[model samples]
Target: MLSRAARPALRAGASLQTRAVLPSSANFATLREIEGRLKSIKNIEKITNTMKIVASTKLNRAQRAMQDSRVYGKTSNGVFESAETKPVEAENKKKLVVVCSSDKGLCGGIHSGLSRYIRREALENPNFDLVILGEKAKSQLQRTNAKDIVLSFAGVGKDIPTFADAQAIADQIVLLPNEYSHIEIVYNKFINATSYEPAVVEAFSEEAIAASANFSAFEVDEELLSNLREYALANSLYWALTEGHACEISARRNAMDNASKNAGEMINKYQILFNRTRQAVITGELVEIITGATASEDM
Candidate 1:
């Protein structure tokens, strides 16, 4: 015969055994949900890793183009450096800023950094007109300074920039009716694999170049001044575009790498949770079976 405490404990076990079916089904559903989420995270990781590889490959070519363009740009500007050229100052003249950014995104803060620099310049001196070379910068600056935009280009930064592309853009800038005291080509400077900063390449007006302090040292035909200014503009623009492309590629690689790492961590955590939950469901079913057998024996 069973004691009073033993009788109550046996009755409670029988009740728990009766309700076990629903709990088991619920636990199984939970496991299924965890599995689905884990699969999705894994897929995301694969995509990010692939993007990282592509960006890394493009980075090398972009850096090489940047180095070559830098040599051409420096050689063109050598005369101005020696002469200590400066922008011709006049009360009526406005400065021109050529902003170089890309249409594509997901490369971290490359676009925002250029926009921020433009904003800062607007605050310090509002006497500048913008000639943007990419949709990214044009879209950003339009929201705040639409009226200041003189021209904007599309289809920029699709691949490694070419000298012909720079020459075409410079031709358009030269055709603008409004005269500028000097031109500033703003772009991202590649510092390292993980670092970049906004920088400017100066392009002087024909008048500014002619007014250079030591201009008399070099004798040249008067007609060549216009040609020299245009050539120098193209060279500077080519340099800016190539350097900006490298910076964008490097930033994208780093961003994708970080994303892949985070997804991997989530997958690991979910996998452990899934295993523990499966074991728990199995243990609960065993307990229920044992309890039912004990009750039958008691009866």
Candidate 2:
């Protein structure tokens, strides 16, 4: 038989106990959520780190391939330079644009840069057709310039591009029914590890080569000119592919490195938050326990 005043105090203490217990349950749930977030961020860091390592390993080989291909391409195109070759521009002459990009992503904006270049060019000259290399560029251009795409290649840039691959692609281009007056290859030109730009390498037709200002200086066999033109196209394609591959690798390494750094920072932030939350929860538990003990003793 408690007095009315004592009953009110007991009810108040019981209400405090209930509120304290509820918060502990909520605290546990919050702690679990923080732990899950921390684990997810850690996993992301691991993936980005692994990607950075792989890109770093591939960069050296890709650079070597690009250098060799560049030299080969220069040598192949020297004859055109010496002859001062120029593309024949006729009203009815068709132009072909070949875009060299990669199949993989996570390489930053390399692919998008190429697509944007082509789109800008298309806006200026809608008469030209496109030949896309790699899925990334193809997928992007398909949305805007689908009608202009005459040919496309996939499974490119998986490794260092081989001369044979270029030859095969050239063969397909040559087999097309329409004879293009000029063939332009668009590729990412690596200026530095972190910088690249879309560039074009021109491949002239035999007619254009024959019309060169200095064509009379060299006595080229009439039959061999066609073969020379084809060989030069292949060389140019190889150069573009190799250079683009190197750029892609470098861009991927940089992207992954940045991702890893950001993930690390996030992990640190989350870790601090988790520790503080845990401490706060512990402190709350301690306060609740002390309050319960004091309440019981007073009773």
Candidate 3:
């Protein structure tokens, strides 16, 4: 028989059991929430998959174009490389830093790598002026103390970069007087559809203004070279954007996967507690029935 004090305790225990089960509803809620999240993720997956396919397709073509053009860039370098005098003709020495990065965010290290390049170069040497491409690089470089920056461009929105853009940039840098004439482009060259390396800001040419302004001479017989340079830079730019998207997709996928696993564990834990609560109630009812029968028989 349950004493008066014990009865109160038993009632309290039952109340506690009900309270424990309260959170069990969260299991269903979790299932529902996951379903919604899964739907959204599915949509995002479709978008990412589509982008991946497009980037890879373009990457293949761009890679081939860049490879073909590299031979010409080598030839051009060979002609100028042998020059005995320093080609950067500026009476005063100045460096032009070209910043390349994605306009969009979510790509893992694409922007981060570019920023590091600027910090190491610009912050390391306050002598050079920066030329920023893409919104990320431009926004980041503003925080630096570099001086005499002549040209800064932003908003090269999507892939499929054109020669016009590169030409515009090349033209601007070449126009800088001899003092600020030497130029380097900081960009992530696309290695594969999935991966891109750090920003490479290689000096394109140190040719004085005469050679710098010769677009016609550079492209006269080397149509293929021009095409290659165009795509190579594009490939570098395009690759960074694509790889960034891939990184973001992978991160989100991993996070969602973990959420699903945790939900499953929680559901299992609650089920165990619920089962134990039910068993305890059954045992208590059995004890009361048996004790009441004994009391009546004794009377």
Candidate 4:
């Protein structure tokens, strides 16, 4: 019942339809891949945005704590400055170095910078012991100077550091079996919202403070010397901890902000690619249909 010419046209149309279907299936697969990537990027953006908000919220409180602690610490150390107190270095006397860092990471190279400074100091003098406050620094130091670490504290920098926290840490240092001639606290000095530097705050021993050339200038009871030293150490620790916390929060906020921006850029790129690919697929289908229709008319 079918003419020969009609059969040929029918077969040609079926062939063209098959070819179109194959490419369309391939295009769909590619579209699916792109969609998956886009979804993943969106999720990453959400996570980074959330982290940025948290860091921003904590930054204000941390900055306030840092300011208050700075004032308190400066006031406490004024006597030492007036007397020009300096630690007496001796080969037999061991030095204690306390590193102030946080347990949480993702805040740029804050903890790493502190760790590097300690490593440099170790190279200069291996006789000093380490007391790390925070897991990040402790882990880094333990890899190389495990034996030199006398104490390590966790759960620090979760919130603004309090005077009580510093007092407890100072009490532990004072109770150590070995007597240290000098106590140095290493912390991130908050220069601005975007800049910070690792610095040291020295806490001299009772003998060192009294040995200063200008010690006679300050009239003080010998009985109060130990109490004064303990108080000064606590005040310095609190200042260091608060300042370091502020720096960490600022760094984290910046890092998360950058991450979110990158994710948004990736999403935009993928969206464009997806749209272009879909348009190309539609154009290909139209071309196939037009070709098939023209062939049928010729038949």
Candidate 5:
């Protein structure tokens, strides 16, 4: 009952209706394929989200512990640095390097940062002795073909770190001959919840330790100074473990953030493809019908 002019409008209405209800069968398959991909991305996003939350929680605790440990470490460093203003005793001495890395994996840049820390020290100091704490660090050292390495620790955290763990490492370093004039620590310093940097290579020289024994600094005698020295050494060991833990959580959080973002992007891309493909399918059907009707009219 539609007029000739209205027929074109009717066809347009039909085309729009068809586009809304039924897409091209060819593109239906493509849409389903994209739908499957979207589902995968959704699952990936959920997993990444869970990991990010866990990392966030763990990082908070780690940061608290690191903060608590830093107070003692700062006191040690300040006293030591100030003491350096005094006269020197031992010069041109051997260097001892303590490396702090992780037992578990999945943290971005942490292992690599620690590895390079070792490489830089080994390459720079010929007389340096390495005391690697984690398996990751040990493996990295072997890869660098740095054979002159010592495994100071096996399982740092079978569960979590304790003062005993630090004590064990300190024992090894302390047992080394005093001819190795200085002790240096290489670790990743956690700056914030999402940022970290390769900790400045910190070395404690005998002179610094001696300077810390200044009568002006602490009203203590040689015996007390010796005891305080032992105490400070233990504090240093504990500080490294806490700082390393904090850095690990920060790195894992960052890695998970990237993963979650990538998943969301994939889902968006697939949805766009599905929409465009469905539209193309509707336009194709419309053109086909219009061409057939024009041919019939001409005949």
Candidate 6:
């Protein structure tokens, strides 16, 4: 121990040990961070997967309801289609736009697309009022078109819409003091599981229905025209609500599926990174031990 060469060897080993300890501690910290991230990603993956499954289960039911409502709505409006009804061209009259959306999110652009359509329409013809159903669209339109929003409804889309719900909403609309020339029901139309688009279902007012090009062909009593208008509006609203619900379910399923896949990918990458970092740290420790042993042996 007193020898000059032995002293130098000890000093060299001490230096090497110091270097190794510092780097090992830093690497351990890095490894801990990576491990924590991996755990968080794994948890995220589980949640996304569960959501995807739930959406998939609900999709079938929503689509069935949509199909049934579509038929009901079309049958109710068949008379108007046959008569070729058209809204009267009155500049003094204001039109009503009913926007169908849901309170919940995670469906890609379903609500936003409807909002954008309304905004674009506002830019072109600013003579319309909004009757928004659901919180999502209401919140969006309220920011820019607060004055235009005459009515907003909540607690919708919690489940499949019943005809009673639509009827109740129609009754409220009919009671409004501001008479509308015509009402347009805007909703996300379900094209397929992977696709949907904004579409409109027209609900003619009593005046518009009466002014049909072939109104005289039907032996309809003039007294029953108001009741027909109300019934037609309810049918159309129910159809829009069901179709929009189906689209939202499908969109949510796709979105959650994609999220789960992305989370899985991240998890895999992080796991590999963690393994590599752990191996590197262990290797560094082993190398330090070996180097110190060799230096002492030389002494």
**Top of the candidates by lDDT:** 2
- Per-residue lDDT of candidate 6, residues 1-299 (tens digit): 38886787677767676765567788989999999999999999899899999999999999999999989899977878899999877888999999999899988788999999999999999999999999999999989999999988999889999899999999999998998899999999999999999999999999998889898898789999999899999999999999999999999999999999999999989999999999999999888778777766766
Clashes of each: 0, 0, 2, 0, 0, 0
Q: Cα lDDT of all candidates, in order?
A: 0.92, 0.93, 0.53, 0.91, 0.71, 0.91
For model 6, the local distance difference test gives 0.91
Maximum-TM-score candidate: 2
- The parts of candidate 5 lying over 4 Å away from their true place are 1-37, 85-93, 157-160, 176-179, 201-227, 273-299
Write one digit per residue (lDDT tens) for candidate 3, span 270-294: 5566556555556655665665555
lDDT of 4 by residue, 106-149 (tens): 98899999999999998998899999999999999899899999
- For candidate 4, what is the total of clashing residue pairs? 0
| Candidate 5 residue lDDT tens string, 152-201 | 57776443455667766776676765555666777778777777776743
lDDT of 1 by residue, 259-297 (tens): 999999999999999999999999988887787777766
Residue 217 lDDT (model 4) = 77
Error in Å for residue 23 of model 5: 18
TM-score of 3: 0.56
Q: Show the colliding residue pairs in model 4.
A: none
Better of 2 and 3 by TM-score: 2
Model 6 residue 62 distance off true place after TM-score fit, in angstroms: 0.9
Clashing pairs in 3: 90-178, 107-244
On TM-score, the stronger of 1 and 5 is 1
Best of the two (4, 5) by lDDT: 4
Off by over 4 Å in 6: 1-13
lDDT for position 159 in model 2:
91
**What's the residue-level lDDT of 220 in candidate 3?**
38
Q: The CA-based lDDT of model 4 is what?
A: 0.91
